[model samples]
Target: MNAFSLRRVGLALLAPAIAVVVSVIVTTIVIAAVGSSPGDFWSAMFSNPLPRIRVNVVNQTAMIYTSAVAAAIGFRMGLFNIGLEGQYLMASFAAASFAGAAYVGGFLNVGLSLLIAIAVGAAWAGIAGILRTTRGVSEVISTIMLNAIALTLVGYLVDRYGVHEGNTVRTTKIAAGDMVKGFTPYQARDGQVWALAIIAVLVGVGFWVLLNKTRFGFDLRASGQSESAALASGVNPKRMILVSMMLSGGVAGLIWMPALFGSAGSYGTSFQFGLGFLGIAVALLGRNSPIGMLFGAVLFAYLSAQSNTLTFSTDISPSIVQITQGVAVLAVVISYEVVRRWRARLEQRVVSRELAGAMGATA
Candidate 1:
């Protein structure tokens, strides 16, 4: 990379670095306040690379990375798509219901279910887009409202259609052979690294290519950076908003697949929640880079996995991980503004010097 590229990369990483340092300091204070030896907590956090733990991290990374991308797409387009939680929930429900209802073999079941999820997610997101474009409704408001609606709607749908087995209501049971299977060399007592991990890798690669290498991506980004400038450059701002929002929701749809296909095999009240909101933090931590997003996801997942061991083995509260996550996200947001202003100031100085030099030469 050139000097400029290197500097940009440095700036990109700076926010996450600040988050890590600040979180550690805060966590140390918390541990000390709790009368626990910080070293013991820290030791357990890094020492375990057990096969099962690794598998859990991989699965968590897959879901979080996909969610990060879903949020990042909207962020790149300057759209706050807070509706990812709703979109993914509806998508997962549809995917589960479809897969359970139909047994079209292996890959066909997976493929059709995926398409259904993408479509449902995109459609749900498009409602906010439509409102934004036609009625001037703020996406933040619309998405939040939609999330509430989705939760309520899902509860009704579940009660009306879901199969009740004892206390838990889940979708129809998928065939054991039909569901995607994960493998492990270490032979975990239960659960393997999700085979759907490949899908997360694919999403990251495709995300890079679409945003960096395609004209549509360019238009969407330009629109985000400045709508007036994008219009002048012949990119329609409204179209970009609608399309980007839907695209974001489409990717968000994939967040549940790793767990659904590789583990849960059905959607129910027990399904994961809050991943959508978490995606926003992960996206900010990622700085819109696929590798950065993956790193952030893995870091968060590792922290969770490590925290699990702490509850069973020590007096330390597992809730410390939650505090670390909150602090890291807050620190990242603060550092991002600092970096932005720093870059702007540097640009202004360079411009002023260039103008002064030109005037001197003319004189």
Candidate 2:
């Protein structure tokens, strides 16, 4: 790339880099204040951030990325999508229930389950969208209520109709034909790498393409940036709201696949939750870019994975990770906005200078 392009890329990276540095410094200070050596904390924190040192880093990172992308979708449309927690949970239950009821083996099973999940998520989010567009309800309030409703609904379904194999309260295990194929990342270890990681990568790619390469993306972004401008430009604001929410919800549905198809092979009372709220934080850290989200998700995942090891290795509270994350998100938000303003000023200066030089030449 040319110098201008390189400079722009550097400018884009500056905020995230600063956020990471600040978070590390803050975390180290917190650890030291708690009577631990910063050196020891760093050593332990970095000791196993990778797959060789740890087994599920990549898989978990992918799941975080999926969640981030889900939130990012609504973010790009200027929507908070706070109900993603509900959307994913409800979708997971629906997918699992349907998958259990259907005996179709192989790719079809996985496909159908995923399809059901996507549909349920979209439909759930659509409720908020419809309310927002038609009745002028604030999405924040509606989604929060929807989340409560979703949890209550899922709890009821699991209690009343969940499959019980002996004592476990889980949906029937998806047949091998329906389950994602697992592979060992390292030859020596027996742990199976989550096959859903592939799907996560695809989700990121698709998100990028949808937002950056399509006309619909333009309209979506325009609406996010200024709904009035988009409406003036022949974009239907109401339709965009509905479509974007559904799209966001559809992607949110995939947040549990890593655990479902790869780890659990069934939905249960014990399945993972809360990824939707985590996704909001991840999206903020990433600034809603696919590439940024990948890095942000991995970093967050590394911290999350470290929480377990940190507990065993030191006297430090594992909640330190949460503090670090909150600090990082706050730093990124504040620093990035400042950087963006600075960059905008710099670009304006360059444009004015070029125009002045042209006028001088003409004179």
Candidate 3:
């Protein structure tokens, strides 16, 4: 790799490390300030029930990593896909709806249905991309609005077609035969290894390749770095924008698959939309690098799971998890700025030395 590429990788790795260290220090201070014993809190966070804790960790890790990858894809293309929540919700509903439809059948049939669900999600996101490219609408605004619309639409669908055979606002349980197989071990119980984790890792690797090794990836990065320059270089900014949004939505759809096809079983009005928002934080913490995003997702998941265990074992409130996430994001953002400035200085010094050496040789 070139020096620039190596430097970028080094800086990407550094951001998360600095962020984690700062978050830990800040969290400890917050714990003491809140009149909690830091030692006790730390212990509770670390030591917990073996089996249940493992399950929690695995579930949280899977969920966060899925969501983080969704957001990271958009971040790489210079699009902030804040509508991941909406896309995820829509995909989940689509998956559940297809599974419940009597016309749907065999295992291969079920796989095709999931592809349809992912396509639906991509189409929904593509709408925002269209607006942004064609009408000059800001993706941030359009996506946020789309999220509200998606929630309401899904809510209505649940009310109209829910399987409860009553007034409840939730979908019917997906047919067992149609569900994605081997994604979660929780099917038979609360905790076990399933194919979902492996799938998630593979997806992450796939994205890493797409972002780092492909021509499309290069165009996307160019568009992100400078629209004018990308346009000058023969990259179609509008097409890149639209494709990025669609890919991002597809990733979000994958996140929904685990919950809908996995043991979670059904969609409900109680289903929340924070995963998309959390994904933005994850992208920021990861500095939008695929590898960094994976690590960031794991750390965020670990803290979330730790919070659940801490809630039952100690007096600490679960709200601390949110605080920790916020702190981590803040630290990473600041660290990125710091690292950027340092890199600039280093580059300037190198240039100056090269110039000086040239002058000496000429003299």
Off by more than 4 A, model 3? 1-14, 165-168, 181-190, 269-272, 354-363
* TM-score comparison, 1 vs 2, better candidate: 1
Q: For each candidate in the order shown, give its overall lDDT on alpha carbons.
A: 0.88, 0.85, 0.78
Could you say which candidate leads in lDDT?
1
TM-score, structure 2 vs. true: 0.91
RMSD of 3: 3.3
What value of lDDT does candidate 1 attain over all alpha carbons? 0.88
Candidate 3 clashing pairs, residues 3+ apart or interchain: none
User: What shift in Å separates residue 26 of candidate 1 from its native position after superposition?
Assistant: 1.4
Q: How does each model score on TM-score?
A: 0.91, 0.91, 0.88
How far is each candidate from the true structure, as Cα RMSD in Å? 2.6, 2.5, 3.3
lDDT of 3 by residue, 174-266 (tens): 677666545343444555544455647877888889878899989988899999999999999999999999988987876756655656667
Give candidate 2 misplaced runs (Cα > 4 Å).
1-10, 48-53, 164-168, 187-190, 351-363
